[model samples]
Target: MTRRAVFAGWWVVAGAFLCMLTGYAVAYSFAAFFGALESEFGARRGEISLVFSISAFLYFLLGFPAGLIADRTGPRPVVVGGLLLIALGLVAAAQADTLWQVYAGYGLGVGLGIGFSYVPSVAAVQRWFVRRRGTASGIAVAGIGVGTLVGAPVAHWLIAAIGWRHTYLVLAAVAVAGALLSGWLVRPGPERYGLTPDGDPPLPSGASTMPAGLGLGEAVRSGPFWSIYAGALLMSFGLFVPFVHLAPYASDVGLGEGFGVLLIVLLGVGSTVGRFLFASVTGWIGRRLSFALMYVGAAAMLVLWSQSTSAPALVAFALLFGAFYGGFVAIAPSLAADYFGGRALGSVIGALYSGVAFGALLGSPVAGYAYDFFQSYTGAILAGAALCLVSFAITLAMPEPARWLAARRPGP
Candidate 1:
C-alpha cells in the first residue's frame, strides 16, 4: 500500500468512528435528557425512564440480526439504513404529543437504529487490520467517547436554548450528515481492495479459499465465550452509575449541579485520552497485562469513589475511571475476535453485548433506588465497586487465544 492507501484506511476508520459516535450520542446521552423530559412534559421519573429503557432493550435485541445481515449483505448498507432510522425516529419524537408517542418514535425506532450500527463498523475495522487489530479497534471505538463528550454538553445547551422538541430536530440534522459520511467512507471486506491492514500477500491466482473459524452457535458453546460474556456483564453492571448520579452526588456534597455537569465533561476527556493512549499502549504491553492492569485500576478507583467528597477527589476519580472504562470498551470486540475468529464475529459479539445490557439495566435503577432508600450513594458506589472487582477476577479466568494457531482450531 502507498501513502495514499494508508491515509484512505485512516479515513475509513474516522468515518466508522463518526457513525458510532452519532449512534452513542443519541443512545447514551438520554441521561442528560431525562430530567428535562420529565419537567417539560409533566411525566414521572418511571415514565421518562421507560422510553430510554425500552430503547436500550431494542438496541441490544436487534443487534444479532444486524450482525447477521452485515455478515451476508455488507456493513455500509446496514449502517446507512440505521442512520436513516435514527433521523426519522428523532423527527417523529419531535412531533410527539403524548409520552407513548415518544416511546414509539424514540424508544423503538432509535433503539433499533443504534443496534444496527455497531457490528458493521466493528466488522469493517476487523476486516482492515491483522497485526494492529487491537489498536485499530481502540481508535474506532474511541469515537463513542468523543461523541459523548460533545453530545452531553451540546444537548444541555440545546435543551436550555430551544427546549427538547427543537433540540431533537437539530440532532436529526446531525444524524443525516453522519449517515451520508458513513456510506461514503465505509466498504465491505478488505480482501476486495487487493491488500490487508499490515500489507499481506493476496490469494494465489487460482485459489478461492477464505479463512475458516467458529460460527456464532459454535462459539457460544465454548467456555472462553462464556468467560468473555461474564466479564462484559460484570463490568457493564457498574459502568453508568457514576455518570448517572454524578450531579446529585455533587449536590449531596455541597457542590453546585454545574460542578457535577463539569465532572461528566472531565470523564469524557479522560475516556477520549484513554482510548487513544491504550490503543498504542497495547502494542507494547500485550493484551493480558494491559487488560488486567486496567480492570484492577478501575476497581481501585471505584473503591476510592466511595470515600470521595471534594471536587479534586471527584476529578481524580473521573480521570482514572474514564481511562479504564475506555480501555474496556476499545479492547472488547478485538478480544472477541482474538478468542474466536471472524466467522460469526458480528453475531457473537452482538450477543455478548446484549448480556451487557442486562447488567446496565440493573445497575442504573439499582443505583438510583439505593440512593433513595439509603439517603446516601455509599452503598451504590460499594456495589458498583464490587462488580468491578468481579470483572477483574473474570478477566483472569479468560484463556489467551494462541493467535494464528488458535485461529485454525475449533475452540480456544
Candidate 2:
C-alpha cells in the first residue's frame, strides 16, 4: 500500500486555523460575557456593545500594519507579539474594577492582538496555495466559525460554573499557547520548502524568486479595489450585529432565558458548515458569484430575523444568516488574492480589510442605539438588510477574477 505524502502547506493552514480559533474564541466569546460585563459595570446596552465594537475596530484597523510587518519580517514574530497582547488584555480585563479598565484591557488588547495575528496568518495561507486557494482559505478561516461555535457555549458554561473573571484567566492561558504554536507553524511562503504552491514541482534555481502580483499601493488604486472595498464597508455595517445581538434578540422575541447559548451555537454550527461548503464548491460556481450570493442571502436572512417571533423561525434565521455570513468572510481574502495576485498579498488583504474594520466599529453600536431608542430591534435589523443589499449591488458590478487578472497592469 502506498501512502500519499502530506503537503507541508496544510501544516501552515493548520497553524492559521489554530491562531484564528484561539483569537476569535476570545473575540466571539464576549457574547457569553455580555450579561456579566453589563451587570458588573451597571452599563446600558449601547455602552456594553461598545466593548466589542472598540475591539473589532482596533483589530481590523491594525491588520494592515500587521500584514505589512509580517510581509517584511515574517508572520511568526508578528503573531507572537499579537497573541501576547491578547493574553495581557485578558489578564488585565479579569482584574478590572471598572468598565473603562475593561475597555483598555479587552478592547485595546484583544483588538490589537487579533489585528497583528489574524490577517497575517490567513494571508499566509493564501501564499501557500493556487489551485486550492479557495478551499484552503475556507478551511483556514473555518477556525473562526469553529471558535465561535465552541467559544461562546464554553464561555457561558465557564462563566456559570467558575465565573467570568476566572474564565478570562483560562482564556489568557490559551492565548499564550496559541501564540507559541501559531508562531511555529506560520512560515511566509512555499518557496523555502523546495516546492511550489499546492506542492507542485520546484521552480528552476534561476527562476524568479519574487512572487507574481501587485503592490499594496497599486492594488488600492484599481477599479475592482473600490468596488470590493465599498461592498465590504457596506456589508460590514450589518455584519457584526448578529454575533453581538442574536442572544438578546432571541430573548426579546420570547424564546426565554438560557436560549442565548443555543442561538450562538446555531450561528457557529451554520458558519462552520458554510465555510467548508461554500469554499469547497467555489471551483464549480466561481468565487465572485458565490460572494455576491453571500451578500444577497445574508440580507434576506436578516429580514427573516426581523419578522421571526417563533423558535423554529429564529432557528432558521440563525442558521441561514450564519451560513451566508460565514461564506462572505471565508471567501473575502481568497477573492482579493484572485483580484490582486500574490505579491505583497498580505498588505493588499490588509488594506481591503480597513473597510471591514471601520464598518464593524459602527455595526453593533448602531443596533444597540436603535434598540434603545425604538424599544424594538426591527428597525436596526431591516437597516442591516438594506446595507447588505447595497453591498450586493456593488459586488454585482465588479468583473470576474479571471478577466480582472488578464487586464491587470503588469510588473508590480
TM-score of each: 0.90, 0.96
Candidate 1: worst-modelled 10 consecutive residues by lDDT: 204-213
Q: Distance from true position, residue 351, model 2, in Å?
A: 0.6
- Candidate 1 residue runs with Cα over 4 Å from true position: 1-4, 41-51, 97-100, 201-203, 206-211, 403-412
- Candidate 2 lDDT at 181 equals 92
Model 1 residue-pair collision total: 0
Cα lDDT tens digits for candidate 1, 95-174: 99988999988887788888888778777777677677887788888888887677777877788799888988999888
Candidate models: Cα lDDT each: 0.76, 0.88
Model 2, residue 45: distance off in Å is: 0.2
